[model samples]
Target chain A: MLRSESEAELAFRREVRGWFERELPAELRDLTFRPLPDMVMPWYRKLSRQGWIAPHWPRAFGGMDASPVEQVILMEEAARIGAPEIPTQGLNQIGPILQRFGSDAQKEFHLPRILNGDAIWCQGYSEPGAGSDLASLRTAGSVEGDDVVVTGHKIWTTWGHHADWMYALVRTNKDVPKREGISFILIDMKSSGVLRRPIRTLADEFEFCEVFLDKVRVPRANIVGELNRGWTVATALLSQERLILGSPGNALRAYERLRRLARALGTRLSDSDKLMIAKARIELETLIASFLDAAEGFRDGRPVDSSYLKILSTETTQFILDAAQTVSGAYAGVKFPMDVDGTTIDFSELFLQSRRLSIYGGSNEIQRDLIARNVLAMPRGRA
Target chain B: MSEIAGDQMLISDNVRRLFDASRALPRARAAAACWPDTDRTVLREFIEMGWLSLLLPEDDGGMGASAIDFVALIESLGDLLLPEPVGPMLATVSLLAACQSPAADRLLKAALGDERIVLAATEADRSLQGDTNHIVFDAHWADVVVFATGETEQFSLRAVAKIDVDGLDALVRNIDGGSLCSVRLDGSMGEELASGARARDIFMRCRNMQRLAAAASLLGLVRKSLQDAIDYVKLRRQFGVAVGSFQALQHRAATLHVACQSARALLYEAARTVGTANEAVACAAAKVKAADTAMAVVKESVQFHGAIGFSDEADVALFFRRAVALTAAYGTAEACHRTCFAG
Candidate 1:
């Protein structure tokens, strides 16, 4: 609804749009779901080469130093053209963190590799006990000469099996409160005793993995922040993480899928079915409006009300996905994409994958609690 | 969302000052007793302020204000919970301004002069009450009552009878309470302004205006409800501490705040796109979000206040009542969802 982006932002959108049209591989224009590394990484690096890899990063760090508007334009244009999102451990997660907390050497060594897609990074924050209550993560790191021996399991690591490096929070001291006694560190995924086991999701997607560290040694220099304050980095990272999570991308994608599914269903879809599809579109627009507002807040350095965005964005995406299933009715259970009438659409895989949106990036339920406590100032109910 | 224009800001400031001077909550409580119906003085003050003429073209001896500016004014009225029927009056004048008629033009000009109050259709269903007339919002004080016959696709207007009617607290008087009355639209009671396609255009214009105003009103109530809750939580203490300091309530309140703000943005967006058939879907979406968010905020506002919120004494209850009534005003959520999803 907010029209007319700044001339430069509009120009940036045009540039990104042209690049996607001319350079994106036809087979991979939308390598959605769990794309194998090869189908997407090379093209992503091509974007990296065009200086479109990480719009949020500083120009000196091999990025466009794009403003928030420009960044939104990039994502929006990319989504519009059916281009898949680039993996963002290096770009979104560790890149900014490293800039803020990494040593010059660490930044120099890692930032360029990330920019060129020479190294794809994966986060290692959650363990069996630490998904939502991340403070209690027991991914241990004990001191060993010139290194920290890490041992524990980290779950839901996106592209963990394909990652070149892992940035993680490891428990370094057990006696202190959970927030303390944790350190943010980077480790080579190729290190001895490292294991990544891909987990198949409801979508049959192998995009996530369970990574095990059997006393794998990460150099002491890899620690980003203080030895026992990884939570600070975690806290600092929330804004950016929420920014990405709260975006309208997932919702837009689901809406697009629903559109295609509805078309495929053709005469098969009842008026009620079509109505549901339209509802999804309306829901998507609301998410888009909500997202742009949040992004503007981020750009202004305003105290962001992100939990609402998180809850709204993720839940709306789920709603769209649910609608996709309804439109695809009966066909929703089919295994592969098929031409329903003239339109080819698949529902099960993407529908199943979208469920993870709410579950991850902090569950919407937990986000509501955070909103109640941190934003609304409600009394904390004791269990 | 771009900023509200400067003149609009000045107008809103004037309204804020008016509410500050009027002691809005007390005014709101007093207004609620009469419900959906309005005092001529309240309408006169609004007309005197040029609000009634705000959206009419300058050629019509009015402000030629943008829809968004109109939104700003309507929202202010909503925030004050003033039980005046601004929407129906605004819609009648704006619609009249668009039509080609010497007599209607005179009536429109007279309305801008605050001499006449016009009440247009505010309900969705076309069925006439008692085989003659149905309750029209603001009909109690209307100098003119206009309605669209869905079956014939025609427009008709009748002089106000000023009869005794009761508001159900469901469709009208969200801010100031009054009796919403049913008027006799049958028996050749009034004049036909337009028919066929022309009538449809007029209907669409008035429908969008009514819905947009309802949404804007809800936006105002949403902000007031959330603000009141925030203030209450900050002051109300438990366990020897400010309850607002607690994380749980903070998040809940934040959710409402976010919802309200987003709905506000949607309201403005809807305003910008209101009149075209191409943007009808967009307009419906905005009203739907506003209605849903406004209801959520008021309901939560009541909860956040605990026992007192459920009582008639708390002004938040009035705000809650207004939110509920406004949700179904113009078009109910079901109607809006149909507009959104149903082809």
Candidate 2:
């Protein structure tokens, strides 16, 4: 709302808003957790067919090439109608990486598949031993003439069990420095030795899976960039990743829950509870404003380090969920969803699930360090 | 850019230049003891710049600048920590113009001409002796006051000279060193301007504008404090490294920086919708967020500077005090939230 949008932007927003309200299925609306691929792919393909699936992708590919404001408007309208969360590993990470660093053959094969939901993708960056210190990965991939034999245990591969492929970071050479020896490659989940086991979360759902690759053979041409250049290839989009993660979508959903909780409680709400709800209101509103500002910065090629936005978005979402949990009263600790005045309140599920927001995507602490070292130019200290 | 946008930009640039040339912050610091009476020259410059009537319509003999342009000027005045009460003066006069009476017009014209200082007495202020003695903000510099009487939508505006008010107490300095006083006003006292719905609309608009202006000022204070602290931490050394290099402080600073950024965005957004259907909700959100963010950032900024930040000599200390005062100015964050939901 801060922007004096052109008539074109306004019209775009209205069109998008109306479409989501009309076309989104009632079952998919306002889901507290991500639905499994089997239930959500049809909706994903619907968005793809509408040319709105890859708003950030270039028009040269099968994408809408929407402007930054248009992209934000798309996200807002989607969240407004409570559109179910869709898998974005291909749309956000692998597809963009391929466009930037992939060969024409690689692009030609995978780009359209991603746009049409024909290939479900998952990121395989975090091996069991390589998380925040991701460069220290020991997952080996050795060249065998025309192929690369890969063996690695990738943990926290979101939707990996259902994904058709994984874009992985493997150690192509152990002789060079940790960051220098890594390679970004794609592996077929259907390969002989590739196995995925779903990991049950605290919320008792299989939102993530552990993917194991035992001598899995993939073509050497599947590598996204020059071997041992994976670190830079992946990092070229670090700021962009932060921008996508820092979006107000999740926070808005949590706020919708908070409003519902507040409305259900009504005059029964205590002053202290009301105050907490008010704080959440302020935080959510600010999160939205902050996202818009950061998005504009991203569009203008302003080198905006969105580490702070990431922290704000996740923490604000968690804060709103906290308020929701607080007002739940006797329903606060219920493991399952309960009906509260006709609204299904999944207080515990949403609240517990949000803990991953801060921990995933380079943990908030790592984000802080990035801001300190990169943005503030603070000197590195031994501690 | 459109002509109006270009003009607004020019107006903002001129205001920034005027504040730079006046050296208003140093002057305010030097005359700290004078409270509301200090920095008359800068205040006169603001009036001469035609900002006091910026929000009034051209039909009322004003420049009729939009609230968006007006907010830009107030944000600058805030960032510079000018002690002139220009924001309060402008907000109060703009409300006075809504009365559309001979008495209101006389007061408005006189104030706009830089002839006198006028301030609004809001309902949010504390009343002593069961509503007889009303506490008014910026009363030390005021020659006249425009206050509302009656209840709800039936309210009417009344104007009174400070000399005409009974039981006028000594000026009480606020946390930021602004002047306030308790004055007794019987129901029938000052010259009545407008009654019923018209007066209610005036009072309502005046309150909303005050909240917004205060929020903008808070944002300015937060920005200055956070930036000064960031600069200070880069220079201040401890344990053989700049203090900012440490993760504990760095994380806190980064969080506050984001808070400041978001608060600024909300303020500008809310300013854009000043007269729209979403005005109440947007304005309340902006005010509350700005006030909360200002307190968080300014307080942490003081800590980031070590012992020096706690002393009066440090500039951040001033921002800290101003943040405290402004957060409670139009309405407390809690009050704004209540009003937002009450509707």
Candidate 3:
């Protein structure tokens, strides 16, 4: 029943575009901040209060329950406005998972906090041993009466330092298959025996943390879905993560930065440079079309595959970042003050940050292998 | 011209159906293997369908369409790896269109239907310049011979075998194993349509037009390659999922798609701009962009296809070879880059 958009969609696009141009804050115009989670929290609250934080959530859960097309429109508007990157573990991953699979009481408690921006969440799925091969995670949790005692280390927990809660996959039945033995459990990060250590990355950013749980206790009611079926929950969350990961905000910001740097330097763009810009423009256009196609697929109740979007959006971000570095030249490495907010940043930091585009939310290499074997239906390489 | 005119979809459902039918024909492949001269039956079919005369003037028994039309038709052909004389035939018609001689008129008329004529532009020992040489060939089988040179000048008709040159076979071999011969022109057998500097002008324009058409054809080939890859990725599953579901391959396909689209947009722009006298630089830029993008897409399409794409029997490799050869044929990307950017 879901067909390509009627004229209504075009009108929606225009309205969204108009609103973005008018309401997007000046401080969010460029990638001038090391966009930390704390710096973005206030804006998150603003969007939450406006019921724009979780566009696809059911209306009953303080969300717009937007159609797939509307969800895309929201993301496009957010990118166009250079909206600050809100910490999304709560809004993007946890809240939706809870609404779909969690007990009513669990959703009653967590969904409101997420909608109010009163609680922040971080994923506790990837352990030191289980990155990529997530089913191999050794995190263990035992049900003890009204509580579950969990003990595991979750690595690469983005913004773990600021999160209020963590949803994790822990082994509940070790004798079962590696995937079936897992249980999804939510833990209060502030609970006793929960420890967090920041992991500094090459970009000199500590956006991720190593979270160690030594017998941390979570309420039994916090377990999502059936026991030892955590893999499905984890898989669902990962699908959401991949979709969010494929968003085009970073590339849009990079383009804005490129234009700003070009203007600041007063450098006359060569025809080739103009051609590059033209190509970038066309890339953006194509990406939008592809995204729309994907959204239509999602809205039609078909399984939404994020492979194409993730690959394209991430590479485009990297390309734009690379172009920005080229445009910035010698000053690319030098940090500059944000014109609106007085924060210092540099193209170098941006370039370093862009490196993660292909790594997190499943490495691009893994994505490529998926595409080759799954999409192309080529024979698998001999191990 | 309306800006929206450029956005008109080049690949329509009808064209796609035509390609599907053409690709299914066993005779098309056999005809392609024959090279320069395609099967007379196939040629007649194409001519009757108006594809062969797509760019000729309507009054001259042809379509009188623009370069964009020519590009759309040629790209469909490239997708099928149809080894028709579309390129040389189109180039010959273009050359005749640029000339005013009685011979040019006669050749143009013949080229619109069953008649075939090959252009001899690449000279031996000329170090890769695409200009037509003074050397002639035997006119015994030729209904007309176009001798073009430079921009804004007329083309003279020289009888085949009237010009003196060595290594014509090598030049012909370079152009997809087509037959070509070299000879000395005594200036006695052919009538001059334009002499001196004017002749040079006409010749350059003709060469540029040929190069532009070749680039367009390559663009078509690249686009088809991408579509082939896309179709393969969509249903091909691995590890319990479609391979296209993997982010890595998706990224590669996406990047290739962007490159192909960029080439297409530029090609359309260039074709539209070709009518304007001052758009020479723009056309050159388009040529460089389209040729480079086309070659890149075709090569990667083969690579992405893995073992199946590399086999000689696979239709993709044919497109790959055509793209590689065409990229170097007209003017190299480097030459176009320099020309467009030159002050």
What RMSD, rounded to one decimal, does every model reach? 4.6, 3.2, 9.4
Task: Kindly report which residue stretches of model 3 are placed more than 4 angstroms away from their true locations once superposed.
Answer: A1-31, A34-38, A56-81, A270-272, A301-305, A337-345, B1-35, B38-40, B43-78, B84-317, B325-343
Residues B1-343, candidate 1: write the lDDT tens digits.
5455687778777756754636767876766554433446556766788867778778867788887788777776677766566766787788877766766677777777887777776544443345544656645567666666644444443233233223322243334464454444552545666566776677677777888888888887778778888889888988888777766776677667667766776677677665544356666787888888888888888898999999889988888877776676677666777777653
Instruction: Give the CA lDDT, 0 to 100, for residue A80 in model 1.
Output: 64
The lowest-lDDT stretch of 10 consecutive residues in candidate 2 chain B is B1-10
User: Where does candidate 2 chain A have its weakest 10-residue lDDT segment?
Assistant: A296-305
Q: TM-score for model 2?
A: 0.91
lDDT agreement with native, every candidate: 0.74, 0.80, 0.64
Q: Output the number of the TM-score-best candidate.
A: 2
Over B1-343, each residue of candidate 2 has an lDDT whose tens digit, in order, gives 0112566677667776876735756655665665554556766887888777777888877779777776776776677776666677777888878787898888888998888888877564555444556667767778788787777665777888878886444676777777667676655877887888878777767777777888988887787778889889888988778887777888887777777777787787777767666676677888888888899988898899889999989988888888887887777676788766654
Instruction: Count the clashes in each prediction.
Output: 29, 0, 39
Q: Please state the CAPRI-style docking class of candidate 1.
A: acceptable
Docking class of 2: acceptable
TM-score of 1: 0.84
Candidate order by decreasing TM-score: 2, 1, 3
Colliding residue pairs in candidate 2: none
